[model samples]
Target: MRKAPLASLATVGVIATEDVHSNTSVQQALASSRSLRSVTAPALITPRSDGRARATRTANFVSGQTAFAPTGVRLAFSYARQSEEFPDGIRRQHEENARVAAGLGFAIPDTPEFRYSDDETSGRLKSRDAFNRMLDRIASESKPASALFIRERSRIGRWNDPRRHDYYAVYFADRGVPIVESCDPQWVDWDNDTSDEVTLRFLHSTLKSIQSRNERIEIVKRTNRGTRAHIKQGFYSLKAPYYATDRWVAWAHTREPILKLDPGVSYVREGCAIILRWATDGSVQVVRDIFGWILGGRSLGWIAAELTRKCVPPPGARYNTARVDGPWHKELVRKIARNPIYRGDLLYGRTSQRFRGQEAVLAPQAQNDAFGKILYLDFLSDPPLSRGDFEAVQERLEANLYQHEARSRTKRNYPLSGVLVCASCRRGLHGFGSAPNRVGQVRTYYRHSMTRGEGSQCPHENRYIAAAPVDSALVNIVHDALASDRLQQLVASEVTRYLDDPRQRRRAEERHACASEIRELERELGRLSEELGQCTQSHWERSLRSRKDRIVSKLEALEAVGATLAQEDARLAAIERGLAHQEAYSATLYTLYGQAPTLVQRRVHEGLIEAVHVDFASRQVLFTTRSSTLGAEACGD
Candidate 1:
């Protein structure tokens, strides 16, 4: 729904300065009713020749008409400096622009004549000369029609951008003032949903900025080209006359004698370049050795002092500063190693102009002009330093990068503890803290399944393997397999048999899948049972009691099947071991017959050993292997 515009509206003259221009919108619409007036405040401030301000105490009288509505008309004034037409580089003329903007504000709605306040400072708002006076009228007792008027939006906030025009618009509109643009004098409605219009305006604003910036850029380029052309023609084209500046000197040259140019700057630059070239060619090693010596034990100041004592020329024969007089100072080192111009290259225009004075005045010498007299100006490139020399310096500066990596490893408490991988899953092993055994003699180990992420993806989520039993057993097995010929033969035969089997392999895969599913289901059932026990409803709870019984039965069946397979696997493993160690089997048979062997051993017999799954709780180990060959039996434990 369209909002109804305010009916009883008043027009107040406003004086908007550059800072305010940025924060206000120029084009806007207001409800034009009979209550709305074309004129605003009458000029209360009269300009004086003594550079002092004078305000007339005369009470504003509305005498002319009483026909169109009954209320007496309120008079006001709007004043603002709108200077969007001036280019950004023309800093000196901003005062003139402000005066022109003020004059235009006075011309409109002539009843309240405005005095141009050209005393505004650039890059600042709120403290502007013209804006402060207008604010006073808006704050008066009569609350006269108030709003600062400007020629355009940008002029008020010339240095800073407005956050949102609507905020400022509503701010003054609520106080009975509305900013009106001279180009398009209308009250701005900030809440208007005009995306396309705003987009077009933004684009126009961007293009204008671009055009202004490009103009400055082109002027600089032209100036440079012209200077180079004059140099090539054997003519000196210094901006300031040589005689006028204390820094300038005139001298004549003999060899390839060209033209009039400042010899002092050129001589210093060429000498610096020669030194740089020499350093690049063969003196790079010397520089690095010097840097290392400084980094190792000597202070930069000490190095500089030593160099000065040795009568070494510093930075192209330029006298070393006191800091560089004794030891190799930082400045001297940087100049010798870091200066790009020494490598026969020239860099220019690295900084932009910024107003330094209180009034924001532009200085003429904003750009770099130090390197202007070389004979081969065309040959110069940015950082004309050689890449090889620069890289050498960088290498020396960063020599400790890998040294720190090694240091960190040595400092770690358990460097290689967690880096081991599981032979079966290939996942990284997890580490538990090391502790002393109950005997306080041997070290005991703790183990947990290595895991990553959350839930099943985490290796430890399935089951945690204890370190104590597995570490002891694995060590025993490795020792036995290596030292005992019987054990080695047994392992080799079993491994080879498992690799040859196909049906055994398929059965093993199916068993693993079933085991995983059953484990998951058991977890779910346990969770559900716990939840059911917590419920309040007795009837629903009783019904769940029957369902729990059925779930238990199903779980029991799965456990039974898993147990059968485990037993069968054990018997086959003993037979394989017996066959491998035929000579030793007679002596070991009696002990094995008393108890069921672990599943890992049984699978080892059937030659289906793929992986060993250890259960930390029961000290039981299950072997995942091929399921092809089933009819094997173990002699004993």
Candidate 2:
């Protein structure tokens, strides 16, 4: 409805219902009307429920006078587009930024007419509304306000971001606005004969202002650290933000605060992510199949495709905080294969995420930055993958890497290549041509160097040998040797040289150091225990107990490592002692040879087998072992 203008209503009497629903609004309107009427008595108007409805709605004959409003007549009414503009008439300023952040200064100087207080705001930027209002009022030409007093720089703006607060004093002072800053005791006390007036006046405040900011920062860091420590005990550090409901979600119509995010900690409820009963379940089969497929030479894409086809939900689909169902991607397969959580292993400090300026980014974790660094750990759920199996899968994954020399490498693929030696020249034979096949569709031969080049036909006797026959002979020889006590003797004789090897010596020294450290820790723990016994107060004793718990955790880890090393050292010492018996030594060799890699096979052959010769005409093979000087054994086919 179009209502008469407030100015026009002053002249015309109108009846309007009083807006009784809002007493404050009606009171304000009435007060404004009174204010306007005091300037010029145009008409008698009573406020209605709507403004209580239009002011001029009521028309009355009073003393038979016709009233016409003048332009100068004031109205106590406000409008949507235009409103009264006046300051509350106070000229006080507050260094409220530091006051909130550091609680450095609460009392403002006694000089200002009024103060602007920015309670509980961050000092990262000039984000205080009160600060802005103060400036606007100070800048207005009507008041032409000139001076402001601050307890200190930190109380006004962050010292780290000098640009935020430095300009107020400088910019305003140049234009006759000059902000007056009252120094705290430190600033007032800091004066010397050599100092200039400006330097002396500002030095203490400047120094203490920065100190206050630093104090605030340290407090925040300690608090964050405490929260992170709390996270270790199966509680969340960050609050349940409204937008981050996925990260910290409560189930529909539930009392749970959020998801059980602590790794290893289990909470089974009707909620996604938070319901953490991830033991031997469907996830086990899925994870096992994923890893098995990867190990079985299936590509990531193939794994993903097959899993999806089988109606398997990917890791994140069911367990992710958001509980959003989706199709599997190759990356999901890769990460699942790589995640150490399934293997019951914990790793930290690989990467960290934080806000840098306005953007959230992932960067390499801290390089010894004590304050900013954080560690994350995972606790094993149940039925974790065996360490050996996990390591073997990782080995296979690493070996699958395609590199410049990967294809050329034959040690792993062909175990006996570097092990076999040419009987005629006593030189290492190179396997060439087509790969060795017993069916003979393609021929592969271990040929000596003289047989390859276009040289004068000066031949070494039996320079070329069929690779399949040699390989077949080699496998049979290994099996036969391992079946007897001779292999054990060979292994012990070989390992005896390694007893004093540098690497072994270093490991022994490390074990010794570990033992020493454990002793020292034990002694320190005893001292702490003694101190703890003397502690009486509940809080003090609690703190001591926490310290002891942390020390105990560290001690337990050290003990585990120490025990493992001791077992290893004892085993190696027994192997050294058993080298005296040929049968025992051979048994040791047999165990080692069974577990050894292809490169170790080469070493084994080089140390024990000396040479292998095959005569196709005689259909016989001669083998010489380093067992003894009279160690030649020949087999005829």
Judged by lDDT against the true structure, how good is candidate 1?
0.41
lDDT of 2 by residue, 313-421 (tens): 5555434645343557787777666666566533332223442223211123333223343333333335346767777777766755532144334332344454555
- What's the lDDT for all of these models? 0.41, 0.49
What tens-digit string does per-residue lDDT give for candidate 1 at 245-270? 11222232312322333313332222
What's the lDDT for residue 126 in model 2?
Answer: 59
- Of the candidates shown, which would achieve the greatest lDDT relative to the real structure? 2
Query: In model 1, what lDDT does residue 549 have?
Result: 82
RMSD of each: 23.0, 30.8
